[model samples]
Every structure is written in structure tokens, then in C-alpha cells.
Target: DKKGKYTVLSEKLTSEPMGIGFKKGDKELEESVQKALDDMQKDGTLSKLSIKWFGTDEYKK
Candidate 1:
């Protein structure tokens, strides 16, 4: 099941996800971000982005 653009590419070549780093005392911002991510998933925007970048909708899981 682990198949996608990265799998199709050579082992030496692969992309990585970006990590979000926030300073302390940003709970409100973090909550808003979490809500935004949830909304994006609900609206299929995340899946669209994944497909646009990876050639397949691998983020639906």
C-alpha cells in the first residue's frame, strides 16, 4: 500500500514533509491552525494539494 511518487522514484530521491515550528505561548494560533487543517481536509483541499504534488491522492487516508 506504500506506493506513490516517492516509491516510484529511486530510493535516493524522495521528498519530505515540512515541519511547523512555533514559539511558546502560541496556543491560540495553534488551535486555529488545527482547525484550518481540519477544514481543509473536510473540503478536500489537502487531497488536492497532495495529488497536485505527488500525482496521486495519497493523503486521503
Candidate 2:
């Protein structure tokens, strides 16, 4: 995406891989969000949303 409008930040922000952040002890909310993401991935909604926003499925990279 060097030619794209925004510069992609290749560096990891932390030792932990990037992911959704939750409030302390928000296990239930985190699990719910994970399940939603999993469902979207299975249903192609996630890829569709990616394409809609980024013009491609970034995950394919």
C-alpha cells in the first residue's frame, strides 16, 4: 500500500500481536466480539467489509 493514501505502519505496537482492545476484566465482551468476528469470517462478511473499505481483502496478503 505504498501507493495508497495512507502509510501502512508495519511495526507492531507491542510484543503482543495487534487486536481489539477491551477494558480490564472484560472477558465476556472480548469473547462476544471474537465470536462475531469468527462468524463474519465464516460468512464472508468480513472479507466483504474489507473490500468495501480497503478495495481488497488485506488478509489475503
Candidate 3:
């Protein structure tokens, strides 16, 4: 049996992509984080995590 429910507030509202904010001039850390995220996406770990946490892989389309 299912127990979850949801409603749409606005059809025009789309899912916005989120980002990690870093301090100014923190290029090295930002680049490293970006590389790690890219690697995770390439290896399917990101999708897996999304589904595990959000019930759906929202990152994929």
C-alpha cells in the first residue's frame, strides 16, 4: 500500500538545478568538488544517490 501524496503548485514551475556555493577565490576547492561530482555522474553514483534519497533520479531529465 502506498502512503505518500503530492500536489502541483504550478505547472509552469520547473525543477531548478542547484549548485554548491564556495567562497570567492576558492577556485582550487571548487574545481576539485566539481571534478568529483562529474566523476560521480559519469559512474552512476550520483543517480543512485538521487533515487535513494528522493525516490526518483531527478537529475536525469
Candidate 4:
């Protein structure tokens, strides 16, 4: 096995969208969470956090 160092020699093979899940009939909670996420997105908070963790603003795209 190559252990000291390694490099990727292929292009991206797949992509998946992430999501948030909650109980099936909790419309109030769902709406609240959705609104919160929307607010973050609108205010640039999400982008900032994404850049902080991933080093790129993947969420904004």
C-alpha cells in the first residue's frame, strides 16, 4: 500500500444532495427550521459557515 503520500488520479465520480429530516407531521417545526435555514442563507451566515468548515462556499452554489 502507498502509505507515505497519495494523490487522486480521477475526476469526481458522484454527487449527492444533503438534507434535513424531521418527524413526518410536524409542520410547525418543519416550517420553523425551513425559515431558519432560509434566513441563514439570505443573511450569508450559511455561506460563512460553509467556507469556515469546507474551505469553499459549496452551499451557496
Candidate 2 segments whose C-alpha is farther than 4 A from its true place: 1-18
In candidate 3 the C-alpha lDDT for residue 17 amounts to: 78
In angstroms, the error of model 3 at 1 is 27
Worst 10 residues of 1 by lDDT: 5-14
Q: Ten consecutive residues with minimal summed lDDT in candidate 4? A: 7-16
Pairs that clash in candidate 4: none
lDDT of 2 at 19: 77
Model 3 residue 16 CA deviation (Å) reads 2.8
Runs in model 4 deviating more than 4 A are 1-14
Write out the backbone clash pairs for model 3. Answer: none
Which residue pairs show collisions in model 2?
none
lDDT of 1 by residue, 1-61 (tens): 6566454542335566666777788998888888998899999998999777767776667
lDDT of 2 by residue, 1-61 (tens): 5577786565434554347889999999999999999898888897898777656675552
Per-prediction TM-score to the true structure, in the order listed: 0.64, 0.64, 0.69, 0.70
Q: Name the candidate that leads on TM-score.
A: 4
Estimate, for each residue in 1-61, the C-alpha lDDT of model 4 and write its tens digit.
7786886544444567778899999999999999999999999999999777656686755
Tens-place lDDT per residue, model 3, 1-61, is 4456765343335567778999999999999999999999988999999877666776684
